[model samples]
Target: MNTQIKGRTISLRLVRKEDAKFIYSLRNNKEYNQHLSQASGTVKDQELWINEYKNRENKGAEYYFIIERLDNEKRIGTLRLYDFIGNKESFCWGSWILNQDKTRSSAIESAMLVYEFAFKELHFASCHFDVRKKNINVIKFHKKFGAEITNETNLDLFFQLTKTSYGDFFTRNNKFIEN
Candidate 1:
């Protein structure tokens, strides 16, 4: 997989077909499914999904990335930007990050870096994320990144960050920090 974004201690890259096994293992972990878009099923089912995802050609519906720790080059998680809708001037985005216990924070940081790439490099007008209402920790983390709650239903809470807003956030949060 070619590296797409590299942070101080993490790397994000395109998911390859060879990664199906790794994805299979991680997706089966119950903890990883808590906030996932879909539930895990049999191994055959997971494999089928991975194959379809690997073969999918529609740029309009999905984009996937694998998150790895730089120190050991370990595949710890995956992130996806989905439901693309709009013109060149504007688009909507959503993502997911999943990892085992020890690498959870790194996964989150990698996700933030990917989001930076999405808004800054890709020139997306806005990015959004939806979380299950029960995932309080993730909700808090999104708040720390300056995401605001825009809508809530019985099942989910939606958060959004416009390019203008995220630019200010990136500046303020890194003003004194050195890589």
Candidate 2:
């Protein structure tokens, strides 16, 4: 799709084959993988997955984005939007991980970029995520965006943000984002 979302602290670009190794390492990293779905095997495995993903007929079905530092353009992590619900009117957001050096503000900035892409660019009615039950950090993070816990399985907790709720959130929190 050759798309990029530029944010104040980071930007998101479509995943490319060149990012296979970086993604593989990030997916397997212990520090970040506890609640994350593990990506085992090798970088070649990731390459194969990427190849298959790129071949999907509907690119909107899955948007895999590499998150990079705006300052030096260093690829730090990734965020993916998928599992479209309500006839692609809404989607599930996941596959997010940021470098340890990136602070909470950086995470928020990256999320702001993702929400902007989902709600503004894609015009999706809602965006949500399934967070692993044990990932308290991320669960709390999602709550800050006013994402309500909607459903739960033994392993995961799902949260969603409606377009209206999201807009209202930004209106209330513009001060925090300004500086």
Candidate 3:
């Protein structure tokens, strides 16, 4: 697979071993990490995890990406697509975090690129993911992008966005991602 998906202002590229520190910083940054799963261990541990993640990435099991600015190549966020279900029928994406000082469009462009890669390149039928109830902003963000809440637990809400719905979203917001 081509490891990089480019958008107008931001791009998603495969995470590398060298990205351990960046990833660690984002996960440990209190401003951004509150809604995310707690990441424990040192940067060395993160590197070890990336080593294993590389193996899975090579096997087409999962993908982790670094979202970076086009003009300066500065990484601003991270997200992953994994937990595929039912023979590529659906995939779950999480570990999404952005810098507190990130560019205004990084979040939107990163999401557009992810869905573009998933629906167009990978041919997935839908996306499935869960958001912590505390992450209200992210929940609203996904809803605005056409994801529907299918289920919920006490702590999290599960969402599903079919490719068809994503097509509508893409059409409505295409200009934001135009090259």
Candidate 4:
């Protein structure tokens, strides 16, 4: 699916094969890899992974997006949706703002765009994520989006956000004015 989500500071587009190097660099960051299930390595490895990701049937897997700075179109992060076990729900995962110099707001904005896409465009009943337990900032960030902890493993916390709750959050936040 050719799709794009525009945020105040960034735009998210489907991951392209051309993005292998950029993605490899971001995923190699020790801080970023701690939260990811798989470790990423060389550009060649990233290319192989992208090939598999692109060919996967949408019947189960949904979307994977590349987050880019709107001003200069520099690739910075990635967002993925998968594990569509049913019609109403799916798993959401992303790594944003790999640039250490960037503000947290950029990552948050990218996530909000993905959330909107999942709940609004895709019509998912709920979107969920598994975050590393030690990632306090991520847990708090998910909470800001009204996600609740549903389950926990030794190293991860599983969180869920229902469509209704997402709508309510936007209502209360009075529309996200992207900066």
- Which candidate's TM-score is highest? 3
Report the C-alpha displacement of residue 139, candidate 4, in angstroms: 0.4
Candidate 4 lDDT: 0.74
lDDT of 3 by residue, 54-164 (tens): 999998889999988888889888999999888779999999988865678888888888899989998999999999999999999999999999999999999999999
Which run of 10 residues does model 1 get worst, by summed lDDT? 88-97
For each candidate, what TM-score against the reference?
Answer: 0.81, 0.91, 0.97, 0.87
Q: Give the number of the best model, judged by lDDT.
A: 3
Q: On a 0 to 100 scale, what is the lDDT of residue 41 in model 2?
A: 90
Task: Give the distance in Å from residue 67's predicted Cα in candidate 4 to where it truly belongs.
Answer: 0.6
Q: Write the per-residue lDDT of candidate 1 for residues 23-122, one digit (tens) a residue.
A: 7777667766766676557656656776687655244345677878777888877777665557534444444555653353574566567567677666
What's the distance in Å from true for residue 107, model 1?
4.1
User: What is the Cα root-mean-square deviation between model 3 and the actual structure?
Assistant: 0.9
Better of 1 and 2 by TM-score: 2
Query: Residues 1-179, candidate 4, lDDT per residue (tens digit)?
Result: 43778887777888888888877877777767766777646899888888888777344376778877777887777777777757665656555435653434576677778778777777788887788899899889889889999999899999988888878877775345354
Off by over 4 Å in 1: 1-3, 40-48, 54-61, 88-95, 101-108, 175-179
Better of 1 and 2 by lDDT: 2
Question: What's the lDDT for all of these models?
Answer: 0.68, 0.81, 0.91, 0.74
Q: What lDDT score is found at residue 40 in candidate 4?
A: 40
Q: Write the per-residue lDDT of candidate 2 for residues 21-103, one digit (tens) a residue.
A: 99988888888888877677999989999999987625567889998877788888898888877764788788888867564
Q: Please give the lDDT score at residue 128 for candidate 4.
A: 77
